[model samples]
Target: MGSLVVFSPLFFFVLAIQMSSLMVSLSQEGFCSAPPILNAADSTAQPLYWKVTNPTLSPSHLQDLPGFTRSVYKRDHALITPESHVFSPLPDWTNTLGAFLITPAMGSHFVMYLAKMQENSKSGLPLRDVERFVFVLHGTVFLTDVSGVTHSLNVDSFAYIPPNSTHHIKCDASSTLVVFERRYSYLESHYTDLIIGSTDKQPLLETPGEVFELRKLLPTSLPYDFNIHIMDFKPGEFLNVKEVHYNQHGLLLLEGQGIYRLGDSWYPVQAGDSIWMAPFVPQWYAALGTSRSRYLLYKDVNRNPL
Candidate 1:
């Protein structure tokens, strides 16, 4: 005689429920041989997750390996990438980080940097001897001048602090600023004053061929040894000619992508990229892609060759 074992319907139901739950857990953990189908229109569907193939790198870093940069340095020019820089605190500054883009070490007489300031941060004191130009990239800032006047600045706003003037900065909100500093070039009976304005309010000067437009941030007067300009180019626009002169330039691409001709080499540049064109280096630019390209250009102007 043989003995027969029997299971109840309730036991089979419980086993099926347990198997379904295990499959769901495995699928959510990316261990399932087949993933559950997701309804495209179902707004309440549970979000799916997948295990990273490489546990060492994050999602963002998985595509870009460490220690790789598009920057290049040459005898006459240098192309600097945002990844090539390390931010550090500067003297007389608190709660701020600065990445110096161009400096005397790069054969630039002027120092240019991109500064990030946290809310409530302030510049320690008024800088001495050096004239400074500050451009607001985003958020709000207040500039207190020698006369105890505090000027509120917003995006696209800029301030020119004259040499030997008392000027301090306080960030009203988290802000990004482009700062340029250099010694004032002394001239007889000529003086520079603290000027404040916004680039959006400036009139755009279209080129003769209408290829591009520019807005002069600083006055063209001789008392100012340096000049800053914002150049805007529509897609497919380009400079009319290759420019080669005694003037040196420190340029920061503000928006869009473009191809820059520096010396004899051509480099692809985009927002956050910086270029330093030394004296007599041939240079030109052409806008690429679908959007407009814009850049902040700084040049040593109104000064005689020494």
Candidate 2:
């Protein structure tokens, strides 16, 4: 097994529109329901039952949260599954917190999450995995890698880990971080031995590089033909034409905004968002706003056939 860590900001944009009458229409038919309570024990505590707990913090921006006089309490992002696991979706602008399990899938198996870290808690559990990537969303942390190397990562700082590499984290005296994890597949059991100077061992390309223009670069074939790449699109730029290829791909927007075309329909996309497209799904996208949009794009080209 092997791992690669490319630390960068994330971006995805999705427009969530709720019509005023939609709430009444749903209640009439009982379409919406309340979520259940969750109880979890810390690494070393008797199993305890817990319900959604709201914090007493106040909204930072008055203009952003109108009508609400104070910050409201919200429940935990995810519900506990019957199997005793936590699976939650990434949080959005309204709530700067959430987490979910990324394991139990064929392509990637492991738990991954995104949320605002607690300022008072400086320690967290470290796990053994093929690889890991942690990006700082806000605040700083003391990151220790497998080799006992330590580094300070503040907002916008990123880190990558190789397969089987052991690493731990220590948040700054008081800081918050958004963590992302990627695990290897033990089922496939086929990977080129980690080799240096080999064509397949090349590192992934990142945005704002000195040698290449990001938005203009397109992989001729899918699975990237190599490692994953993060690209950026300046306002007004776009991948206007449909791109059809054999590789499966995941695109997560890190910044800016745009409309993505997927089979006769156009979907709006922006930062803190993601989309999964396979070979059969022909898709393309274009930037839609004034801000430069960046995104994390990952594709595994040399995996065994399903």
Candidate 3:
């Protein structure tokens, strides 16, 4: 028989305090149980973990633990969160860190990545025969174009670099940018010019749904092989219908919370989430909270299926 060992009241109180401290530590480390999912359509519902917490975590630390993630990968679509991003070096990029979010390996026709550049860092020689688009997410940068004109870019500023262009990027401050690149698909007697603009200055085009709007980032002309657009949805608004289209998309949620349908599954998404949809994949989205939801969308355009 085991003997009864009486513990003092002081000892019990100390033990309770220790346990509480342990729980707090675990929660900070993201090892605690996830909170329950809130009702997607209830505007008054409390924000869930995916919406309120920082999604960016060191990839090395996440490797050993079973952490909660909304990210999913399928044959036709994928949802990527910053927690899974692994920063790596790209050739010719000096003092810059990059994490590729979409690539040909993921069955996408283009490559998109998040790049962080230290002050004075530069993106070296432009790729031969490839077009590039850059959107500034933070800080400032100076882009020297093929024509040797330097343009300053701040948050929300974007530039489209034409194919085989001799251009380079220099960080004026510590900066973060979203970059998209692909081989240019040439159109007979057509050519693309370098474009620079700020999203904030673009006029919004109202959609059939009064709550939805769009800002076209690139010219809608035969000379351009692809296009980027900013789509905004007011609170409680949703796509009129689920869409199944031939356009492959690489989208980055820029603001607010929403429920996104990719193929047969629906996911709760928020700012900083990236989604990739292969051609003909079914997709839709609805803004869930009180704030508006906006995303940068990319699709190949003005091209034949052949």
Candidate 4:
């Protein structure tokens, strides 16, 4: 990992209150347990795992982690899952680095992360130019956006933040959160305001047989940087129900098990697994087991190619 030497000189303003208490907490590793360790070295290893194994070699800045691979990324079977990092919630902040998962994408450059923080900890990330889309998969977290309004984000809690907005996050209990962030690309027509919501509060759009149901997390009325969706697929159902997409997708399977079609290959996927597909690549999905398959998905839309 040649890129480990360049850390952002300017870190966000966050003071991890319990330095001693924090180090001790890692031992408990409750629902927020660290990534599983691979006893052997992997050929597909990326810089992230290297840094995880060797923190002394870490660079101070945030950049493209490009961990895993450019194609399908299965968390459990990854040749290398970047070692999780403990840093500030915000990339610029150098404190309380939370253990993070980093993955690569095509159109937009995003090192996505799935973070778990202990209860009573405050994420010392100040809103800067970072555009972040956060989803709470487990537990609860309090999110304060640029408007100075704080919302309690629990399981299925989702929020979107535009660039240059000031926000803060503090947790009274242990929580697991996933963050998808990339530089904001501005276009007058695609303008959108901040969005804060939870799928629990939204109606599930479904068909008569309940074959497919979708929870639209981001507003599609006006296009913005990207769109997030939580889709539930009945067992044995396929996502290609006829419509395909011109938009690229970065997806994470939140629940259930299934076979996913990517380009020309089909791979078995389960909860905690992820996939990144390019625009126009042939793709579809089929749920497995006895229950409905659900996933929190992301897509880039509403902007023209530069």
Q: Which stretches of candidate 3 lie over 4 Å from their true place?
A: 1-67
> Which stretches in model 2 have alpha-carbon errors above 4 Å?
1-98, 101-112, 120-129, 173-180, 185-212, 215-228, 304-306
Q: Per TM-score, what order, best first?
A: 3, 1, 4, 2
lDDT of 4: 0.58
User: For candidate 2, lDDT tens digit of each residue in 1-306?
Assistant: 679876432222232112213432443443333122112233114211110011111222223335533111112111121122222423322213354423224233334444444443343433554454565545667767656878777654556554566566665354433344445544343332221121123334544423223431223333223343556667667674467766655554555556665554445544544455545456766775555566655454544657
Name the best candidate (by TM-score): 3
| Tens-digit lDDT track of model 4 for 5-41 | 6533122101111332242244234212333322225
Instruction: Note each model's CA RMSD in angstroms.
Output: 18.2, 16.1, 11.7, 15.0
Q: Local distance difference test, per candidate?
A: 0.77, 0.43, 0.80, 0.58
Score candidate 2 by TM-score against the native.
0.51
Candidate 3: clashing pairs of residues: none
Error of 3 at 243 (Å): 0.6
| Model 1 weakest lDDT span, ten residues long | 48-57
Error of 2 at 196 (Å): 18
Residue 256 CA error for candidate 1 (Å)?
Answer: 0.5
Pick by lDDT: 1 or 2, better one: 1
lDDT of 1 by residue, 1-306 (tens): 899989775465446445544544564454423343333344124221111111111224324345656789998899987767668996789888888988889888888887889978887553566899998876789999999999999877899998888778998678888889988889999999899998888898767765788899889998999989999989879899789999989998876666788876767676778899999998988887556688889988888898
The Cα error of candidate 3 at residue 144, in Å, is 0.9
For model 4, how many clashes? 14
- Candidate 3 structure, TM-score to reference: 0.80
Candidate 4: segments with Cα more than 4 A from true spot? 1-108, 124-128, 206-210, 241-245
